[model samples]
Target: MASRLVAAAASSSSSSASPLARLISRRRLAGGADPHGPAKVNLWQDPMSPSKWKEEHFVLASLSMWGVVMYGGFKIFAGGKKENKNEAVPTQV
Candidate 1:
């Protein structure tokens, strides 16, 4: 009797999954596999390999580099601007 019950339970579970459940399971299996290329890692984890770094990390690094460059250029060119501001305005009488 116990053997029959176990077999029945197994058969029910195997065949009775809802359509949505089957679809979700199939989607997960197909979409979760990244077979097109190798997986990426964090920037800090592998600093030497930019190609292996994740897309977001590359974007962040690029933005940060540009920000630094812009800031440095601004500072280099802005040094003369401060002196102009310090000049005394002509008295309005």
Candidate 2:
């Protein structure tokens, strides 16, 4: 009677295993199921085609341009260092 119970348990265990195996074994491509448009190229690869440049490249370029603009504006508006009149010139011995 124990041997019959063991045999029934083994069969049930195997039948339950197949569905889990099927779920785990599914294959999908990288970047799966997303709607993709035309492939983007590097900014240097196609300088004129801003739309075709990679998103990261566009962001970096935009940030760099803004940094330059801000620095230039600051330099232009900020007054240069002034000399202190209180300091006396050193005399030669």
Candidate 3:
């Protein structure tokens, strides 16, 4: 039992010399990321996993999406001012 513990510690110490292990060690030694800052979490990751979504979440999303759709519709019908100027502007004669 004591031998197994010693062997495990030896193996771990050996692994600490690995390239991947060294990168992890440097990050830890540098104190890693700002713990209090907002995270740039991946989109594929479940956003609700760490925090539960309340009514505010749905309300905020609904308002934002509503604004987006409204702006899109306005852009579609307004025939925007820059279209003629940007469209394949003809070069000199």
Candidate 4:
């Protein structure tokens, strides 16, 4: 009975899984998609028709404006706190 118990324990532990199973599972999850698929269609484009360059250009311009606004806000808030020592010096003294 003791030998049977020992054998069962050893079998269970050995059956646990090799590293290859884990590696394969990870690869299968990560490797399926193409990294360079075509860009997504804009809302203005019909699903069946190819997207026009003008529509893409409009979208890019809007995104660029949004980025500029965000950066301008950050710069304003960041630079607003700093006092210019040269401006603070009294020239009339």
Candidate 5:
């Protein structure tokens, strides 16, 4: 029973990577561009001028960093609490 529970949990937690890989490949193909292709126009360089681009980049980077930090912290704290509840109970010999 314990082994079955562990197997079920493991299967649910670990998914096949092929679907995600295929999705990314299909998206790349639909974009009609090589993933390793040449450089495109830089957001910070143009006759139209990317003045706001720098500010946008800074804001987005800051927000992303904050999000990652907060998420990691939350997982570190919240994961332990959930871990205790979800642990598989030991079976009698």
Candidate 6:
């Protein structure tokens, strides 16, 4: 009984939406403002850019450095990759 009522309500609401409204709603971004303009781009997404650092730059650099350090620490504590034991090929006669 309750399931029938919920199904009827959902069908009515969905049918009331115009085709254009449904398209617009379906195409909208999940959590951001309306998708009407070009996507935002960082002028200095490249870390090697000559542009001076902003607060975000510092945060990005720190995070990247921390990742490198953490990886190094893991390698040190967990043991690194084993070296190959295969014989080398001759390059010259």
Q: Candidate 6: misplaced stretches above 4 Å?
A: 1-52, 82-93
Cα error, residue 39 of model 5, in Å, equals 18
Worst 10 residues of 5 by lDDT: 19-28
Off by over 4 Å in 3: 1-52, 82-93
Scanning candidate 2 in windows of ten residues, the lowest lDDT window is 19-28
For model 1, residues 1-93, the per-residue Cα lDDT tens digits are 565456455556676665455433223366666658988899999998999999999999999999999999989988745444577889998
Q: What root-mean-square deviation over C-alphas does model 2 reach? A: 9.9
Instruction: Give the winner by TM-score.
Output: 2
| Candidate 5 off by > 4 Å | 1-53, 80-93
Ranking by lDDT: 1, 2, 6, 4, 3, 5
Encode model 6's per-residue lDDT on 1-93: one tens digit a residue. Answer: 565456555656777766454333243356676656544335366446525455566678779889999999999998888898999898996
Screening candidate 1 with a backbone cut-off below 3 angstroms (N, C-alpha, C), the clashing residue pairs are: none
Compared with the true structure, what per-residue lDDT tens digits does model 2 show for residues 1-93? Answer: 565456555656566665444334224465676658888899999998989999999999899999999988888888556687888889999
Q: Give the clash count for model 5.
A: 0
Superposed model 2: Cα runs more than 4 Å off? 1-24, 28-31, 79-93
Q: Would you give me the overall lDDT of model 1?
A: 0.76
What shift in Å separates residue 69 of candidate 1 from its native position after superposition? 0.4
Q: CA lDDT of 17 in candidate 6? A: 60
Which sections of candidate 4 miss by over 4 Å?
Answer: 1-53, 80-93
TM-score, one value per model: 0.51, 0.52, 0.34, 0.30, 0.31, 0.32
